[model samples]
Target: VELILIDESLHLQNGIEAILTMVEENPEILDDYHFVENIRQSIIDAVELELNYLKTKFGGTTIFGVSYGELERYMKYIADRRLIELGFNPQFGIDQNPLKFLQKEDVKKLTNFFEVTPTEYTNF
Candidate 1:
């Protein structure tokens, strides 16, 4: 199983109804940093608990880790050390121009550059 460390900031969108959208879609986005951390911790606990139970039955030897420090804690607690750190290499600037969504794991986020069509008029 792949461990996904979802970045909360990645979800925010800069739009006229940003706050309203946040409230409707994910109220968690408005939560304070500490409160959000608590939620993440609980999620980590649940995954560890499930992994512990599964290990007893099948004894699999692999951990795709997104957080090494936290994963080490659970690994020690459960006494399993077959962790493999998932790598994230985000490319910026011109370095990312060559990459595409169809490409490999290491990605370069491309800046969207497009022309907007001239509108005849603006209406409310």
Candidate 2:
């Protein structure tokens, strides 16, 4: 498998924000749903802990100390797509992908584990 390490703080925050936004937009969905209430509360508690840990350890940097240039842009792109899938407006307006720096040949090499076609990989 191709290993891809992501910044947990950023990813988690994106997820939390999406969930919170969904709840805000559809408050009625939680009115009689104890299961949804429990899940939402658990997410809030976990997100609070994660935010505190990230702030304590990373300070102002969301990616910790990793310096994968343009990776942040790619992440924002993906986050925006996720937000769209969640019925929320995209937060970032980035169009170009930083991972586009990877050549088609290199992407082909990763296809064995990535399970994406060369064209799909390049577009991604």
State each model's CA lDDT, in order.
0.35, 0.51
Q: Name the Cα RMSD for model 2.
A: 9.9
Candidate 1, residues 6-104, lDDT tens digits: the string is 121123123214545554688766456664454445445655786577566544444442234333343343221111111112111122212132122
* Highest-TM-score candidate: 2
Residue ranges of candidate 2 with Cα displaced over 4 Å: 1-67, 101-124
The ten-residue window of minimal lDDT in model 2 covers 1-10
Off by over 4 Å in 1: 1-31, 59-124
- Looking at model 2, how many pairs of residues clash? 0
For all predicted structures, in order, the TM-scores are: 0.26, 0.33
Error of 2 at 16 (Å): 12
For each candidate in turn, give its C-alpha RMSD to the true structure in angstroms: 14.6, 9.9
Q: Cα deviation in Å at residue 3, candidate 1?
A: 24
Error of 2 at 56 (Å): 12
